[model samples]
Target: MANLVIASNTKAMKKLDKGTKDKVWAFIEKLSADHTASGLHIEPLNAAVDPRVRTGRVDLHFRAILFKIDDKLGDDPTFIYMGTWPHDEANKLAERSRLRVNPINGVLEGIIGELDGEDDRKKRTVVPDPRGELDRAIKSQPKSYLAERFSLADLTERLGLEPDLAERAYAASDEDTLLDIAANAVGWQGSALLDLATGLHIDTIREKHGFTDSPVDDTLDEDEQILKALEQPASKMQFTFVEDDEELRRVIEGGDFAAWRTFLHPEQRKYVEQNHSGAFRLSGGAGTGKTVVAIHRARSLALSDPTARIVLTTYNKTLAADLKAALLTLDPNAVIADRLGEPGIYVGGIDALGNAALNQAGNIADAAENVLGYRGAELTHNRTSADKVWRDVVQSVSSGLDAKLATPGFLENEYVAVILANKVTTLEQYAKVARPGRGVRLSRPQRIAVWKLVEAYRRQSRMDGSLSFPEILALAAEQLRLRAEANQGFFADHVLVDEAQDLHATHWALLRNLVAEGSNDLFIAEDSHQRIYGQPVVLSRFGIKIVGRARRLTLNYRTTAQNLHFAVSILSGAEYKDLEQGEESTDEYRSARLGPNPRLLECDNAADELDKVADKVREWLGAEVDPATIAVLTRGQTDRTQFVRALGERGVDARALDNNPATVGHVQVLTMHRSKGMEFSRVILAGIDDTHVPSAATLRAVPEEERAEALLRERSLLYVAASRARDELVVTWSGKRSELIHSEAGE
Candidate 1:
């Protein structure tokens, strides 16, 4: 008797499982005899269960039944069984049982499982019928639309469901049931159902026509096949989206050149053409492409003289990287590297280059000691010092000195002479300069007395060097004077200084040594309208000859017309009274327009103002604007940090521009001073109120005329800030209105 029983009512035989197995076997024998009696041949038993089945070792017992089925069958034979197991577990067990049967039978059964199942007559089944409900749903859909084709994975993603859930929905018995399950699974709506239906219709059509075979013409390309498919109305379904491969290819190629051209501006191109001289500065408006020019200029110089060493250094390393990328693109053969001493193009920041030079000269440690005394040396050794040591030095120098000595007014006169004369390369040389020069030379007693004064000042101020800022200028000037006396020509062929307006008298004296008499290759680019830092150092004092050599680029390409106009109105004072103004003749900036009218937002408090700014950013994003184009300008780093934190809390992408180098894509949030020469798409000038603007009483400490000039510099900074915006400008403040704004508005 078979241990595995096939019964019509499986649930009813639980109480007499052993007896039922015997009864089932008897029934099978009787059926075989009946068939023989009716003049039909009966095949031998295909399979039967073993009676030695045990609970725990049921898998082993089931193996015998499967073997009988496999050995007795001449060809593939069907078998059925009744069991009490979880549906999934039971299916797995049934598969295992079938595998242990005839190997050929097992293989055929696996193939059948892959096909899902067939009707009672064993014909391959089509996709389940929708029955009444699906038929109604299909009728409601437009004739222009069809069912969609999607994999179970695609359905899972679209529906935001687990993979298993989507798979179960797909395996539903009928179209109506599948739709019902999917609707519940995915929270179906009008558009969602339409999308699903479209996928299904495509799938059904593909299956019905057996469209898996490749077309006969093997020589035809994929694009040609796609075009051929499009030609057939049935193949070109209603919802299919197509792309023109040829047009797409052209567009991709065009974008590369466009990006390249944008990065290399007109000034940059001109600079590249006229690349000569070891030291030349490329200074201009921010987007006027100084960095780009520097890159190509370096490349051109490298090509002209392969052995000529070149260094492309900026105030920012990121900018240096950008410059390096531009150079590589211009000359693919150019050997450039990021590290300082690399054989090719060396790119770094100003300080980095300075440090590199100092390191090579073995003077960086000495220079640090001279500028910052014992504490600096300790900090240098430990590498844990705060970065404001220079600022502290400047402050200490200003505080201990006589008030008259502290004035910048003494720089070009008394200061320039002292700094020019004081260079002690060795300890012996320091003894010679201990005395203040009397007529031509000093007596021993007078020298000792002067040395005592110098030593006292050095101890009190905690300075390593005896020379002050003015003394440095004096010493540098004396170097130039002595060089002329000796008839030795200027060391450099040409001299160019960037941010020329910020240079003080001492700076000028040092720079003078680079271009002595008969040096005509002096090119300086200075925008008097953008000197937003330091004391009022006159450009005229450098001599009008230097000013005459400068060529002006007056086109306001960075900002839109409205922003430019507003900035000009604010800064067009007596100093910049004769300045030429116009738009840049470039296509990039030609059609750019202001998006909104510039406004000044005022609040009763700082925290309230911050909340308002956050709210505004959220509103802008909601209006479909990209977060990258917005910027928030502040007076200091403190404001920047606060604003950044507030914006972050409100889920806005905000970054403090402090210490972060500017890139082409970033929305720069910087001080007005830092924003000099740089431009943006949209600018927000924050804290433009009384306490911040016009500053404090420090302007009074400066001479009245100099103070006026300093105020003009502030106006110039405002001009730069306002003109940075190529599209929209926003000015925000708290408390009293900024005097500069009021003055400009009145004008």
Candidate 2:
């Protein structure tokens, strides 16, 4: 008797149509219970280049290519389901494809084509190196990191890895080396790497791939061995396996990216399960699976202790809702807590946490005033909300001052970044505190004048009984600190922050007090290049230290190769910083997949752009692509509204994405900001006109000296929109295109 294992979702399985998929599902369901050659049309393929390669009839016309492997220790054989195809195509595929263990890394991989050097590629043992280190140390080898350290000949032997992918990965140069040597090496060395560079120093690749963590048990059947590797994804990794019949169905019916939630890239899985002494930061470019790690991190914590008091939070209510949804998707049966510091996982926006804590403090206004260092300060009950509320205060207080110093933007920056950030209540403290990241310096008299504006803004907020979101966070942090000092409040055991780059300093202060300082207190995920809001603040300034515990994810799980290059070029010449105030690295990053170059359509006006958008949408729909997977992102609410109206007139039935479920029947439209933490199969960034992008109103408010910095944020916003596209992207503009848009590298 032999065992049957449905290898987890593959690109091949995803392409099968419904009728064939249903048949394949029925075939596997029967095979799992009874894998007899008679019950199922299973037989050896005489045409296959390798005798072990076989074909099994899924239905009358469809046949699945099954790779048969005998247990290494001589036990029952195992049948692995590769994919389903037409009977004729399945025979052609089995004729050329063979599964073999890489002599260098000892990882099993499937390959097509002839082996160039049959004698040179000697088999290596499955035992890993004793170093027990990550691949980061592999880069010490210098030029052509992997090529210099390991034999490229042995790497391409047995045709395990494509020769071109190996050449590009090991080749030397400033531009081609966009992907980091270590990140790319380990990234591809796993199941994903069987298609790329598969050769590395045996000692390094073995240890890096988790062989050192635990050696493979050869006495067990091959199916059991692979199951162990996949189950222990963090400690030891190999294949993507579907353990049950339901997962097989999920793989067979691919859409909504459900399979991705179950199968993680090994590199991402490492971060999800790694431990650190204090705060740890995992930052990566858009689509590198940072959010994926955040979701799994919550589950890992809760599974370790069901009552761990884990709070998974983000910047806004929308993103928090998304996180909560994703957390539930990861584990639907787990109980979600109703309040902060409760058992199980609690997902919510940081501001919501502040409101809840303040409400629990008996009197919200009293808690806020005390945190402001103005206890007994007259406060009103009205809560009016507004952005940049310092224009009138600056105009009325700063006389004979430089116009740049008196702008509402500059004054607001001083008030939020320095005064409130430092909890300074008096004008003397404000005048003496240092202002970092502020372009223009201020004289003592000028500081005194700015202090008056800050005071007035605070006074106005109090009178209206409205505290800014930052003020709410500051107040919440104060309450947490006071309660912790008395050792009474039940605080979070672990706090995981996603979209960390957009959080204000006060947000970090509250998070710092939410969890006690110990091992694995905080796990942060962010990408500064995707930061669309909130100014950058140093994490250490708020006492959340991440000095030595940080890792950058360099492999992208979304975005095509061509679109990634285009999106990255938009960030050319811009500098970004990490939470520790260190320069962020954007190089050595690589795309996991490739697609057609992003389309740049220039037009006469927005009407013409919308016309072209409708044409593309109609064309994609005609081809049977799911409408729910198509998105049209815009620069503003105005453009979002126009997209919906214009597409409806064109008979596309486009709908704007809101809190409701309008996902299936219509193409979705959304402002770029609303599109964060989301992905689509196809995207059209419509109406990127000059006047709309880097919106004139936004730049008009900034001081002249800091315009460059403001311009960087705008580029980041565009990059964020471009990378949301997973398979294809089309950028359209009217009149003159935004100066921020850069031509593709080759163009």
Candidate 3:
């Protein structure tokens, strides 16, 4: 049967009135079920540039324009471009449609071909060829850099542009001009050329576009090639059948434009469906679909092996819950729904795994409320009870007459970031261990003093009969490793971690020991640019090797170019690294769509800022953007509470995000920390000022030497907050704006 594909041009549908849209949906349903139904005249348009352009009647006054898919691939006539056209404009619309594959990214794009007329030429003189201007700019560069190292053939072969255009480009000037014109180039043609010239790997380029090394025979004709392309499961041109009517209706009504997850980009499918021998790491920037890949990979494993046990986890509860909900959606027919929660596939936060192990070992205290001696001292001032212990017990313990020892913050980090993180128990182990990333130095006497502090903290933790979250992870890891050595069975055969950057050092250790190091043992996806908690970890220390098994995804399917650019600017000055300690950069990252520049709202004071934010939100609601697609992000829980209350007072039914996975139907208010791994159509980052962004408490807690690290973490937090926006971003400030905001913005 021929397939029915919906072009990603959602704006075309949005331009119609509701009554017309409903009629259009009815037409599509009938066409998908049976294209030959009476009253549906599906015939080719003679005026179209592409021979495959066709039109189908929706009503006497309205029609649906479509592109015909080749029948040799399948007997069913594959139709795309489900745009409703008025009777008067049906022929004009069909004539404008053209189908072609982007050479750089291998995506099938439905473009409106350029029209030619004397009148049009006259109108175009106002804006000269932006490409010509670019050509002139690069003419000043060294001749060899343009003509010798790179050539016109390279551009033609890389971007899959017209031979005439490539010839014109080559005959014009230097390679620098070609590179300079990249921003002005139409569609993927210009962007891919620029990326190629700038040193992105060919493999990455092919992966981004859904191309594989195994090629279809070159002798195949155009129709045959297209048929082969559609047959491949990962092709962007491939169609997914929406069997469930209610689900189909929900997808259209909800404005979920990206289509179904079953149709994945080839690279994403490669990661999800391909099995690896041991460990694998996938890293990408915000909106790169890392979490989506993790979810699909879990389903893939379960389907491939009926007896397989899989655990899908992340750093926090909210995100894990999100993953579980998404995973459930993979079963469109409810085929595997019954097998999800047991020995088949398990999903939860990584911390829950530690708790489970602790519970199994019977080590955690069930009712030790007063054992730690911190229950009565008001722990709200610090980050956690552990922070208080570090300040009061660890920092206060020192040598000399008046306790004349080094500053205790350094010692505290030494114990946690280095010692306990690496399972260092003895003084000798602490002394000999190399602090590769640590900036502070310590002498023998200082080491003794710090070790003594560490010993005191351990003793107190034992006496309290309670363990911090990190300590639990460490103890669980040790217990699991011991069990593995003694030839014992583990909980899950496969483990997949999403948002791996936020995991603590001991969590990494625990994950490493969760199962024996073998086929499909661990798969982790993370981006250091989204690290809002804990410190960077060296994966080699935990025996997870990613030397040749790592992949970087640079194309962001979510977030617009405008919003993504602004979000990336926040981290441009900061350095980021992967779990394996390799330096990571986002210079090559690009977004799928272009949108309006993010709005920066500056108000007189805190109250004024809140009022302005509410006003803008009201405007968005008036514009008919879904309330569920809007979110308000704040720096801390207090700010979240304030914003939620203020928005509620203004008649906006806003709800603060909590443990529940679903956040639909109401405006969501959440802290930046809680906003990780979530995206929205519109986002408002409120109270992004100097004090609240970095949080005065966070700054005061860090040692002076590690202040830069603290700021970087804050910058990452702001970056994550800003990037969650898909189409629009509004960043507001009250008194002093955050330095994290790009200087060019708000002018």
Q: Give the per-residue lDDT digits (tens) of candidate 2, residues 10-99.
A: 333326667777788888777766777575887887766667777888888888878776667676667777677777767766677766
Backbone clashes for every candidate come to 24, 4, 4
In Å, residue 227's CA in model 1 sits off its true spot by 38
TM-score of candidate 3 on Cα atoms, chains taken together: 0.77
User: What's the lDDT for residue 695 in model 1?
Assistant: 61
Instruction: Rank candidates by lDDT, best first.
Output: 2, 3, 1
Output the TM-score of candidate 1. Answer: 0.48
Tell me the tens digit of each residue's lDDT in model 1 across 1-747. 221212122211123344434443443343322322332122222221221111111231221111112213243222222222323333333332321111110101110111133411121111232245434543453322122344443433333223344445545444444434433321112113323432434333333222333322346543233333323222211111112223222222333212332223233344555533322333444334444444556666566666534455433444455556556655556866444434456655433443343333322333333333332321121221111332343354423443332343322222222323343332244445432211123345533433333333445433442334433333334444455556864433333334444544545544454344333333344454555644433433443243333333322335544455556666543454211122212121211122344666777787778777777767766776666677777776777777778788877777766445554433445677666545566678888887776665546645443567557666767766776777777777778877777444322
lDDT of 3: 0.69
Best by TM-score: 2
TM-score of each: 0.48, 0.81, 0.77
Worst window of 10 by summed lDDT in candidate 1: 102-111
Summarize candidate 3's per-residue lDDT along 1-747 as a digit string, tens digits.
346666543233336666776777787778777888876788887766788888888788888778787766457777775466577566665776666544333445565433354321111111123355445544643443335545544554544555444544455464445554443444344445445544666455555655555445467775566555554544442334454555556545545434546456666777888778889999999998899899888888887886777888898877877887788776543223223224566777887777676455433232122122232221111223565665567455654312323444555556557876666767888788777667556777777767777777766666665467766666667667766666776766888999999886678887887777889899999999888876677888889877688988877778876787798889877888888888989977876566688998889998999899999889999999999889999988888899999999998989898565536679899888878888899999999899888777787766676778778899999999999999899989988888889867532
Runs in model 1 deviating more than 4 A are 1-257, 260-268, 275-292, 311-348, 362-498, 503-524, 535-549, 574-596, 604-608, 661-669, 676-678, 697-705, 742-747
lDDT of 3 at 492: 68
Higher-lDDT candidate of 1 and 2 = 2
